[model samples]
Target chain A: MAEVEISQLHKTYPGGGRPATRDVSLTVADGEFMVLLGPSGCGKTTLLRMIAGLELPDRGSVRIGGRDVTYRAPRERNLSMVFQSYAVFPHKKVADNIGFGLAMRKADRAVIQDKIAWAAGLLQLEDYLDRYPSQLSGGQRQRVAVARAIVMEPDVLLMDEPLSNLDALLRLQFRAELKKLLTDLGTTCVYVTHDQVEALSLGERVAVMKDGEIVQCGPPMEVYDSPASEFIGGFIGSPPMNFLDATLRRDGGEAVIEVAGQRSAAPGSWAAFAEGPVRIGVRAETITAHRAERSGALRAVTEVAEPLGSTTLVTAVLGEQRIKVQVPPDFPVGAGDDLWLDLRADRLSCYERDTGRVLVSDR
Target chain B: MTAAGTAAPDRAAAPDAGVDRAPLARRRRNRMLVQVACLAITAFMAAPMYLITLAAFSTRESLNAFPKSFAPADVSTETLRSFLGATGVVPSFLNSLVVGLLTLVLSVAIGTPAGYALARHVFAGRDAYQLFLLFTRALPIVVLSVPLARFFITAGLSDTVLAVALLHTALALPTTVLITASIFTAVPRDLEEAALVFGCTRASAFRQVVAPLALPGIAAASLFTFVLSWNEVLGAAVLTLTNRTLPAQVLGSLQWSPLPYRFAGGFALLVPALIFIFVMRRYLLNMWGTTLR
Candidate 1:
């Protein structure tokens, strides 16, 4: 197993348009589960295809395990991939599908059998070895596809949304299984997925890509909490971070943000940005019900209350703006009634509304 | 819907209504009438063939009889041997086999690649290239055969099996290409991509992955080309006189020639079709599916 380094890769299609994957650079450490997460057409799959050597880059080099394999063919790269469509050979039995690569190298019959058995057993696909892909269910076909790639035991395992076809419950369950299997195998994997939750749960480090470039890359929680920019803050969460326009000021040893109807105290970091109207982002869970008349804060009238059993989602209107809050399930708030939103100044991230950048000190 | 469109399916479906659960007598009679009509048409085609076969095997007296025997009432190998002894019937049969096999090989070699390209590749002249193939296939062989034969004779290739095979390959090229193109299109693009990612080169992926999967189709296409070559008389007759293919040999024979040769020649033609059709039986669904599409 070895780390894969894609340095300044540019993949311009032969038709001569914008590069599908631009000057993108990211590393998948040895035995690291690195997820390339982005929406469709964001170049995640293109990058993975380049790593697998199925697609060639117009510029830059790809080093796998310290060896430059940029111009090499996929077979020479010693990488196996499980495609999003679960590319199991429809005509072949599950055993045949898993044993195909081994057969290609003309491995010993006993060795091929052992490898097929081992891979099939790991995937819980022993009973279906004799069955064709058309005879198997969606999840079962996907498992066979995974088993086929894993049987090769390549230096790197590339997966392109291998669980996207399964139904909701199956997807979640198989995703957990997939993570465990990858971890147990100790294979370095570069996975591409669009689902943020899947990325968070599967990757040791998630690289968020946009427009053929890596916008942010960090551990799941670090990227979730300390978002580097407005895009990161906007993209990381479920309902997404809510942003409201407010003028910043420092009055008597306290940083304050004054909206149209109320004035709220800010975190200490907001002092450097005490200028004109800026965007303040609050996580849905950050704005809790502040009914006790707590000092050094502001209040907003709750416009809509969505109680989601374990937590309540309250979209409180701050004059012309809307700020979402994830409060305790038992928060005393309802629609049309005024509710207090106690946004802790620390959790409220400030951004330049005009430029859409983080309004924080360099430190 | 227009009256014509509405009535079309109803007219098509009317005959089959007899198979309805507990079909009424009138419906069954209508169905029987349609079946009888179909049977009559089949007989219309097969009757001459049956008569020819009977006249071929029978003595001269049988040829001048009132009506022909439907079955091989007095089947004999005597006429077979006499036909085999006729002006180089054995060599002509072998020549036909050689030409047919050659045609099948060349057409498949050229057509399958063109088919795969047309199916998968998007090139600058792709549509125009396809239109070219369409026009080439639609060109009547009658307009080209005499000139082509003359060209072959001048080139010192006339009356050779190679000349006939080349001519047959040209005739069968478009049909073979179109057949295999439809076949390859049914295969998914993702499968090929997956194979590529697994380290197979484009050609290897095609050979090891796609070609095996498309075997049924390719085989069918080759068989079709083979049949076209075997059955073609016009080009084969003109292109090769000495090493005449079976159809050329049969057509070269005089109208009043021994009836036995007609029976044997017709029987020889029937053999390849029987074999070719049997070979395609497994892929009947494939042909049907293509038709549906």
Candidate 2:
């Protein structure tokens, strides 16, 4: 097990739009599963490739186990990678593909065979070692790609959307299996994916990237509970967080938000906060749908109600603005019905309209 | 979308020919005509090659005694042995092998990498180089031989098999590059990247991964170059005398002695050409496959 330190890493492509990776720095401790999470073209793959030494960074160094390897060749760096395309050797048998690195290192035949057998068994491929890639199914090919990487027993393993090619059922199954395998082998893995749920489920710490830089990096639960910015708040959830345009005013030593011409009185604990037009974001679960309440935030009409089995999602308009809330499926709600919503003040995050910076906490 | 759709037909009114016909009979008739024409062309091309093979294997008596029969009455080793005798034939035959091998080696080493660079890497004057190679190939050998022979004489390279081999390589380069370039195109660039990510160095990646995969097409390209060198006589005759290739030796003596050995020598010269074509038939089809795709 070995930690990776990428210090001030920058990659400027030949034909520049911007730096593909702009002064990004991150550290992963030994045995930590860190996922570089982002949408397509966000430079997550470039970061992983650079860390693998398959790509060279323009202006910074990548160190593994405290050894600098920015200019090292892939073999010299000793990191195994599984590509998004499942880059298994199509011309080789499963056994040879898995044992490719061992063969390169001039390992003995018996050792290679035993290692190949162990990897094959770990991936549940006892019967297909002699088969070519063209003869296998998509899931099997993915297993082969993973098996090939793991058999090398390198210091780190970089996986670039390794399950993106598999079917949904197979992806879920393999994701769990891969997590277990990495844990058992005690290899540091840096997984890259755009799926936030996959990052949450797999990564011990998820680093959210956008526009060639990491905007937030934290434990998955920490990132889920307290997003750092408006972008992160809107990006991390399934139905996403609800944000309504509002103006904050200081009145009688409390912060009051005027949303859609209706003033939402703050809880008095947030009285010393900023006072101006701002955007208020609340997660879907934080906005509770009730008939009417005396102590909480607002009264509104439920515009659209969707009963999604165990939980229900209701899109409600607080005056001129619409927001979504998760409630019980059997909650009394339907389209064009009036309802009351108790906005949880402690869980609320307010962002400045001009800056989009989260003012709730240093999250 | 409607605005864009109207642009194609606004200039004309008589548009009956543009509509697809719905009748099955017309389509079937057109298909049948195409099939029959295809069959006729296939048989037309097959007939000459079939007759040539019959004549090549026929005995001297059977070849001379008739309205040429499709079935020769006799086939013997006497004519084969005489055609491969030591006095002149064996030396010339050995010369053909050497020239073909040299031509194959030289052309392949230069052509495949040139093709890859053309297909992949982009640099200034690349198109100019390609056009230059094409122009070199388009010049007929007989036209260039006059000036080339003078240059060879000046360099003291007169009457050598190497001179003829170099001339043949120049003739084969354009086809070799074009074919191998198309073959490399069919194999994905991702596979090359995959090899690099594995433990291979850049050159080792090419040697271990890309080379084995490109072998069939390279084999076909080398085969074509060898055959072209073997069957070449016009330049070979001008370039060499003591080490004349088989085609040069045979073509120079074609009519002076109409002995059985003469006909047999012609057959012997034709044999390797036929073998090369047969060996590369599948890959030649693959070349077309890759081209169309």
Candidate 3:
């Protein structure tokens, strides 16, 4: 139950061209689940390592529970971490692995036993307590690793893609369990993952990172609905948001963007900008398919149709750019069909054409 | 596919099938041939050791007889007792034990940290250091021993077991470091980092996590050191006179000794090494983890 404050943290390996982490600042409030989401080599793990005190930052500071501990060793930090590799000691039994931190702190035997039993029961690992790590399956081993971290009852917990090694079904199963467990404990956690779905499902706040810096940080839906930059917009979704370049205009006090030989009303907030070039980003679900005769709707020639039982995804080409529009499963659309896309103005976000930052209105 | 599906119902009668018996007989013969070859090699390796043990425990009359018998006619303790009673043999035997143990301790203590660093740390000249270790092995022990003997005498450390042990440690260190480095490399750094996050320091993490996993490999290296020091004659002879190791003492007077005395002394020198290997056999098993079958 501690707030983790990291400010201006930077780390660069010698001989590397760029810093691994650069000027990254973040504050995770008490009992918050903050996920650092990014692709590989994006410095999320490096940031987590620096906070754990396993790695030293080249610049700036780390404060845990309001105490500066940037220079302290990992042992002195009083925090626990679950590694991506599920680094349970092979020589120890599952019980011993989960109780290692308490043993390191020289806790009483009864207390250590109590904590180990509690964590194991919570993880449904009580049956495997006496078994060695090699005897357990991947998912079970990951649970043991989580049990090991949580048994310490640290002020904060750091996990670095702890479910990445498990198979698809196991990852999904453990992902839900982990979310529930983290909520039950209510300990401040800083988790790192490349999976956007996991970030959206587990994070109280998601910080999307790119090239060693935080590109956008907000609640999952906020970051999704209004990404601060083009990079965040593209990286945070499955079939990521679609971007179309268009010239904006305000005809008769109604804002609209002209694209592919047709004019469609822009997202409502774009009215703040004077008529000029802007990039419009709309999620797949926000763009709906309609009959070609609809007035003021942009026309796109459908390239492919993927009907996924409950919904159909139609990828269409509009003015030399590809955009995917989510439609109803029974929607009458197919490859080579010409249709109108009703771009929901209220659901769209507009960014500057060159700078890629959102055009925020004072209102 | 049809044959396999049809054969499933007659599985009980399939064991007596002539078609299957042909391949089964061939496989059995091939397996027998492989076992025979392995046993022959094992016998070839074990014969000399068995013969030496037999001769060492046999009567002097039997050992001296021409066209030596393969089997012991009369097993006796006379030859062993006389070899033990030989002047300077007992002291040299004790000295060899001390030197071997001391060499093992010194090499492992000095080489383990260097080995671990070479395995895990990235630093300037790391490859150069490894190359230097490999290059040291190219130097002949005999070539260095003479000068080392002169230096030891000048330093007033000659004619003592300590001098021989120090020389043995220096000779064994290169191999020790390389072997231990590979061993440490095999123990993942992830376990150590995990230990650190669980509240152990870097040193304690290595001790608590890495060391247990690497114990078998380290034990192998220690056994190598002990055998090396136990068998080394040139350096031990050159470095010591009064406190000679068993190998140096035996080799020094080898030609002059009778056949039974030579065999008995050789067997006596080998007993400790055999006991050591047997004692460490459990740790030497390749049981590190789940990666291997």
Candidate 4:
């Protein structure tokens, strides 16, 4: 296995008005699984392609296994990639497709045969070894593509939304299998995806990107619990973290936050910021709803209630802002009902109203 | 209101069966019409081949017989035998085959790379170059062939099969390039990139992935080039004397020859082109949609 070190990569298409990637730098340690997660057009794919040497960066350096290969061709980079389209050669059988890299390297015939069998077994594609890609189902073709890449045993494996093309159940099953297989093999991987759940589940570390720049990089749980900015908070979660307009004030060295005519204690770190208009960001599951009025609890009128099997998502109007709160599925709530919301002080994130930057210290 | 609501559905349901039956009947009629049209087109295309084959194989006296019989009666090969026995016919036929095959090779070899560039790259003047190819065809062959003949003589390449093949390659290139470009475009770019990532260089990737996928299309272009070179008379006639292709050699004599010999010559020219199309029909079908799932 090899570590991939990339530094100060920049690229802009000739006719594109904005750059695709802006001074992006990242490193994946030996045998580490790193995922670059973002929405479409955020340059995650561009960054991965640069590392694979499929695309040359306008200005940057990429070193794989301590060898500078920024200007090298993709073949010279000693890497393999699985595309979202599962680009298995339609003309070749599954066995030949998996053995293509070894054949290109002029490996021994017996070695190529052994490697094909091993990869086929790993991908559960032993039965499909003689089938062409055109004859296989979408999921099977994708497995063939993965087998093709892993059979190469290259320095690094790059995947660009490889599971995005599969159906929901197959994608979930394959995602879990892929995580286990890659972990067992200990191959250095740099994967790009727009799906948050895939990043959270498959990656040992997730690097979140936006507008062609890496916004935050950390363990998935840490990034989920303590996002670096409002964008990261809103982008990373389902029923994304709700942001409500509030005011922060200092009261006897304690941080007091006022929202919708109710005052509550805020996180201690918020005390460092000057008293001004701020936004209080809280996750959907962190807020509790009480039927009766309570001291220090903000009043809200519920607008919609959607029961999602395990949890009920309640959209409530608090003053002029709309916020979503996840409650127990059995919680009795509906539109037009008045509820007092208690935002968890420790879980609350304070953000600047004008800049959307987090006002509190990084956790 | 409840009675009227119930009555309205009943009224609607009563006509539903008739509505369905009307559409079914109309569909049947439309299918019949389509079949009739197809038969008409097929007959229109096949009639000439039928008449040519009949005339070429018939006895020589049958050509002058009044109220000619469409049905085969005296199916002697006398006319065809005499036609083949004529001086220079066999030699010219061989020359035509050489010129056709040579043109096919030269055009595809030169035009495929240009087509690949047009399909895969975004270099400057790309659109203008494509337009220039089309504009080359707009210049009349009749206008260009005389000067071309002179140029060939100056280059010491006149009156040769290679000279006619060169002229045919120039004539066939625009169509060949355009057709092959579209073929290459249909091949997904991801397959090529995947090959590159799997240790194949750009050239090898194209050879292994793109070329096999593009074979059917290249075959179609070759078929067009071969037939065009085989049948072209004006350019071949102007450029060659003793090395004339079959069409050029026959066109000069067939106008003064008797009617049966003319029919025999026409059948000879038609046979090779038909065989070529027969050979390439499967690849042409592949180009239409049966490839790559």
Candidate 5:
């Protein structure tokens, strides 16, 4: 319903070390789901809280629905937040919990009742209307929290890791349900989480943050396939991207990249770098592992192989570097097996060895 | 020879089975010991009330009889009736009730907000303020009573239920603030934030979300305030003369009165406190039973 614009937001707690957020700006399109994803202590939650009007930024303005709401209180902002703890009122029954916001607005009793019923039905909580929160399981309490937020029909919805408290299996189910529910409702949402998979699956666009700054923000696959920095290439993938030390040299008409004593031609974009040393970044799944010795392939000693139904993750040592390689589930390899790894040239990313910034990307 | 050998092994195996039974028997014995100790403590606490009620309802002559019977024989209401009929006794009893109720109201009214601030905010000197409250309690009432009485006289409020109530409030506020702060602390901050995000203002959020959860704790503080005000004699005695509470009014005359009247006065004072505790028992249990989510 409302697009949120946050600009130049900075917040530093008293007795501060590093600021919680620094010069952060983001715009969430109307009805678009934006996920702020990062590890703990990375300031993603701080940015979300600033947008919610829960925490005041030291220097920034937040505009929601084209209105300047930077100084407004949370209730005045016409937004609802689902806390990580669910935070359902324990003293109230599920019906009252869902109806709290409408009651706060002094809605008509009949309308409040209708809205409560609709939300309960939507959340599959009709049978639990009369039950106290203590009687509900973790997942049910979370549903009650979601029902409460949606019943208000606020301009925007803010969720701070709302699914984190549930058991792993319930988190997955609720994650899917939440995505479907929010999509059906078409409410502009800003979700904060430390989960990469949740961000990759649910977000219309994922904003990955580190050390109080947005490192990369893009469509999930775009960010995954073309991480802007070495930090991101390692952060976004399962088993993460592998980084290997390599030397780059001009070999006549082409740049030759050497890793672990094996040589391959660099992508054409790398012709600009007067090569000495560079880091090679490759996804685990992009490298093909062969049992036989192959020409133009680096040899690695497998340390461990984890069978994960669809794929086997093999951690192998090539030279002094440890790298993960995704192989077929039935790949016949185990500890101490020799594997000839063919690093696909099209999928490889080259980064500056000292700066960890990408020098050349295949795409 | 085979029978002897088999019997020897069976005897050896019997001790292994007894080893398991030993701990079970010891556990049962320990449980019985705990039950017995609890019974003994209950009797120890209840003995005085039994004796006082028995003595209070006895005929005046039976109290002075040569062989005092523990059984309630020759029961009469003569001494209790006379005690109630004593000049200023009923009035002082009413005064005590007013003072206790007033103390409960005033302490809770002033203490709850301070408690909430302590629980919710991180102000400078917060820890020092808490320590100051505890220090105020360390000062004996005997030291504060005369000055407090003088201050009340100067304000033209001496010798009234209000004066006694004010002194009692001062006495009870530290515990009231501390107890309610702990109660409020147990209510999650997340609930308040959720209320704020859901359309409730700060005040309404507190009233709707926090207060209901903290009600039992507030009740506990009120109970403590009432009992402290009810039983306190020195401060009441110092602060009031004509508007004396029950304990203050009786302490002056009862020590010189006959034993029956003394017993009657003691029994009269004990009943109201016991009744107050009985009334607030449910809320007190709720305070203990609460488990935060």
Candidate 6:
């Protein structure tokens, strides 16, 4: 395994109006599982391809294991990649596909056979060694692709949305196995995916990207619990974080904010922004709901309730703004039912209205 | 009011179901008539081949009799032996085989890489070049043979099998390029890229992964080019005088041959093409049956 360093990387197609990736830089430590996550066309895959030497950058350099490899061919880079299409050779048997890299490197025949056997055993593909790729299912083909990359035992492994083609159940099952496998091998990896769940589960450090730039990069929980920007807040969560416009005000020596004509004391960090317009971001799970009417709570009528077994998600409207609140599934609620939602002060994040950057917190 | 108005039509239409049977029967009869017409046309096109084979195998007496019998009276080797023993006939047949094989090699060797580039790369004037290939199809071989004959004479290549083969390559190249390009396009690009990432150079990737997958398409194109060159008459006749392809020699000497020899020559000329198709049928099936997925 080796550390990878990229600096000031930029790439643009010949006739593209905008660069696919611009001024991007990142460092992945040895054996680190760094995931590049964003929506489609967000340049995550482009950055990963640049690191793999499959794509050349317009400007900037990449260094792996302290050696500059910006202009090296993909084969000379000694890096392996699992394509999103699971590009295992359809004409080759599974064992040959897994041993292809080894054969290219002129490995001993015994060693190639041994490695193929180990990979097939690890992937539970022992019975399929002699079968061509066309005979395998989608999940099996993806496993073959992984086996092909891992058998090389390269210093770095790159995966681009490898699980995106599998069905949801298979994706979930394979992702856990893949996470275990990567950890076992301890190979430095750069994975690109648009799936938030996969990013959260698979990445040791998640780099949230947008418009060819990194918006946030940190441990998954840190980036999740404390997103750096409104875009990160919305992109990282399921039933994403809710945002509401409010103006800070002073009431009886304390800072307060009003929502749907109901006023509540704001966190003390907002004292400087009294009478300033700010956007509040609250996670759906952080919002508490009470069946009985309570004081200092925003009154709303439930518009939709989705029961997800243990926790029910309730989407409701307070005045003109809509908010999603996750409550206990056992809590009785229906469409048009009046419910009171309490936004926890500690769980709320405030951002400047126009800039969308997080408001400074004193803690 | 609209619901009540629509309900009345449903009751009125219930008794009209029997009226549909007559049209259905008529449609079935019409389909049967079309099938019979197709069968008749197929038989009409196929009958000449059957009659020619019968005549080629019949005894001279049976063939020349006043009452011409359509059936093969008796299987005889005398007529075939006479044609095979004719001076220069066997040599012409060998020349046809040599020209066909040479043309197949030249066309594929030059066309495969051009087809690959057309299928894979984006270069300036690529679309225009492809259109030009298609446009060449409109030019007749007779028009090209005249200029080719002049060039061959000046180069001292006239009356040689190589001369005929070269002309045939020019005739077959456009079809070869278009067919091989489409075939190469069907082989996925990702497989080659995958090989490259697995420690192969670009050339090795194509040799190891792509060529094997595209073999069926290549085989089909080879068979097609061979048959085309084997059967071409105008270019073969114009380019060669002494070293004639079988078709050219047979047509040139048609008046001098006896009736049995003419029939035998016609049947003999078809033998190699039939053998080529028989040998290549499997590859053709693979090419058109299941697409590369």
- List lDDT for all candidates, in order: 0.83, 0.82, 0.88, 0.90, 0.90, 0.88
Q: Whose DockQ is greatest here?
A: 4
The residue-by-residue lDDT of candidate 1 on A276-349, one tens digit each, is 78888778877767766666556677788898899888887778888788888887888887767677777777
List of clashing residue pairs for candidate 2? none
In candidate 2 chain B, what residue range of length 10 has the lowest lDDT sum? Answer: B1-10
CAPRI docking class of candidate 2: acceptable
Chain A TM-score for each candidate, in the given order?
Answer: 0.95, 0.94, 0.98, 0.97, 0.96, 0.96
Please tell me the TM-score of chain B in candidate 3 relative to the true structure's chain B: 0.84
Could you give the CAPRI-style class of model 6?
medium
Residues B174-270 of candidate 3 have per-residue lDDT tens digits of: 9889888878888877899999889888888988998898877888789889988998999898887788999999988899999888898789877
Clashing pairs in 3: none
Give lDDT tens digits, candidate 6, residues B26-93: 66667667777887999996787787788888889988887787777788988888899999898999
Q: Is the docking of candidate 4 incorrect, acceptable, medium or high quality?
A: medium
Question: Predicted chain A of model 4: TM-score relative to the true chain A?
Answer: 0.97
Candidate 3's TM-score reads: 0.88
**Candidate 2, B64-169: lDDT as tens digits:** 8857667656767666666676367888888899989999999999899988887666778988987887898677778888788888889888778888888888
| lDDT (tens digit, per residue) of candidate 4 on B1-293 | 12211222344556564565666556666766777788799999999988999999999888889899999879989999999999889999999999999999999999999989988999999999999999998988889889999999999999999999999999999988987887888889999999888888999999989999888788887898899999899989889999989999889897689999988999999998899889888776655545532
lDDT of 2 at A110: 98
**Each model's DockQ score:** 0.52, 0.44, 0.72, 0.78, 0.74, 0.68
Model 3 over residues A1-363: C-alpha lDDT tens digits? 799999999999788899999999999999999999998999999999999987899999999999999989988888899999999998999999999999999999999999999999999999999999999999999999999999998999999999899999999999999999999999999999999999998999999999999988999999998899888889888779998898899887778898865799876666779788888889999887896668867888999999998899899999898998889999998789998888888888888999999888875
Let me know the DockQ for model 1. 0.52
